[model samples]
Target: MEYRKFGDTIVLRLEVGEEIAESLAALCEKEKLELCQVSGLGAAGQITVGVFDTEKKEYFSREYQGDFEIGSLTGNITRKEGKPYLHLHLVFGNPRQNVCVAGHLNRAVISATAELFVRVLPGSVGRRMDDEVGLNLFQFSQDS
Candidate 1:
């Protein structure tokens, strides 16, 4: 993976065999990004996404194998409990005509390339597990 830092933004270029989330996480840590917004478009061979089942208090994950177009990857990233916490949603356009799926991003291996737009912010958002919802949600912090 190669990235160019431009002021408060970083343009990430994912190479062959790079997983989107993993690479992004590494970039965030290396760059020391405390708060940021991430968006991108890419193609993937295999991917897993989540569906939070409130009643079950669990995340129901679905995996897809085979090529698909990454429709809209958008999320906010923040340091939570000293770790980079990324919450993103994805919409995939299946290679087969007339098929599409959307869910919370889990894991995706790049097929050819991915272009990411990341804007680094100066702030912090604390996250804690919400037992009833069974998710780590942000509690916005003003201190940078």
Candidate 2:
């Protein structure tokens, strides 16, 4: 992966064989990014995505193999116990152009290249597990 920072925004490129979530986590740690917004587009050979079942408080994941074009990738970076935490979603189109899948991102392996942008936000954000929702929700300052 290669990247250049301009002000609070980072422009990055993920090379073939790189895993999307893993790469992003590395970048966040390397740069000490606490709060940010992430977006990207690319191609992948293998990917796994999950759909949250609110009622069950669990995720049902599906894995796809073969070529796909990333139509949209969006998410955020926050801190969980001072460590970088990422929450991402993806929309991808199959090679046949007949289907597109959208869900919370699990894993994605780059097949070609991925162009990504991360915009750092001011102040910090944290996450706390919400028992009622069975998920982590963002925690903001009182002034926010």
Candidate 3:
């Protein structure tokens, strides 16, 4: 993965064989990104996405192994308790026209390439563990 800052936005190029979510988290950590919004599109050979079962508080995942077009990838990068936190959602279209699957991105490997644009925000969005949900969530300034 390689990226360069273009004013307020950072343009990133993800190479083939790289996993999207993991790479982003590493990048965010390396760059010391406190808060940002990320979006992009790409092609993937393997991917796993999931729908959050709110009632059960678990994710139901689907894995696809083949060429797929990434429609939209959106999420954020923030530091939770001084650690890199990456959250993203992906929408992918299969071979058939108009047939697409979209959900919280679990894992994905770039098939060809992925171009990303991340806009650095002005303030920090930290996270802390939520005992009720057993997960980390956005913690606004006042919560700090």
Candidate 4:
């Protein structure tokens, strides 16, 4: 992966065979990012995405293999117990462009390249696991 920081924004180029989520988390750690917004577009050969089942408090995931285009990728970066936390969602289009899927992104291996943009925020943001929702919700403080 290659990246360049420009003011508050960081542009990243993910090479083929790299896992998207893992790479981003590593970058967050290396950069000491406490809060940020993430967005990207890319081509993937393998990916797993899931829908959250609120009633079950679990995710229903499906894996796809073969060429796919990332139509949209959006999420956030925060901290949990002083550790980097990433939450992302994706919209993918099949090679034929006849099928599309959208959900929380679990895994994505770049087939070609992924161009990602991360905008660092001015304050720190934390996450707390909400038992009722079975998901991590952002926590903000006045000083941050």
Clash counts for all predictions: 0, 0, 0, 0
Candidate 4, residues 6-117: lDDT per residue as tens digits? Answer: 9999999999999999999899989999999999999999999999999999999999999999999999988888888889999999868699999999999999999999
Question: Which residue pairs clash in candidate 1?
Answer: none
Candidate 3 structure quality by residue, lDDT tens digits, 1-144: 999998889999999999999888888777778789999999999999998776787789989998899999999988776777888999998767668999999999999999999999887888887767856788887543
**Candidate 2, residues 7-98: lDDT per residue as tens digits?**
99999999999999999999989998989999999999999999989999999999999999999999999988878889999999886869
Q: What TM-score does model 3 achieve against the real structure?
A: 0.90
**Consecutive 10-residue window with the lowest summed lDDT within model 2:** 135-144
lDDT of 1 by residue, 1-144 (tens): 998989989999898789988998898788888888999998988889998888888889999988789988999898777888889888888767779899999998999888899998877786877776788878765541
Residue 14: error of model 2 in Å? Answer: 0.2
Error in Å for residue 72 of model 3: 0.2
Ranking by TM-score: 2, 4, 1, 3
Each model's Cα RMSD: 1.7, 1.9, 1.9, 1.6
Give Cα distance to truth, residue 30, candidate 4, Å: 0.8
Question: lDDT of all the models against the reference?
Answer: 0.86, 0.94, 0.88, 0.93
Best candidate, lDDT:
2
Q: lDDT (0-100) at residue 121 of candidate 1?
A: 85
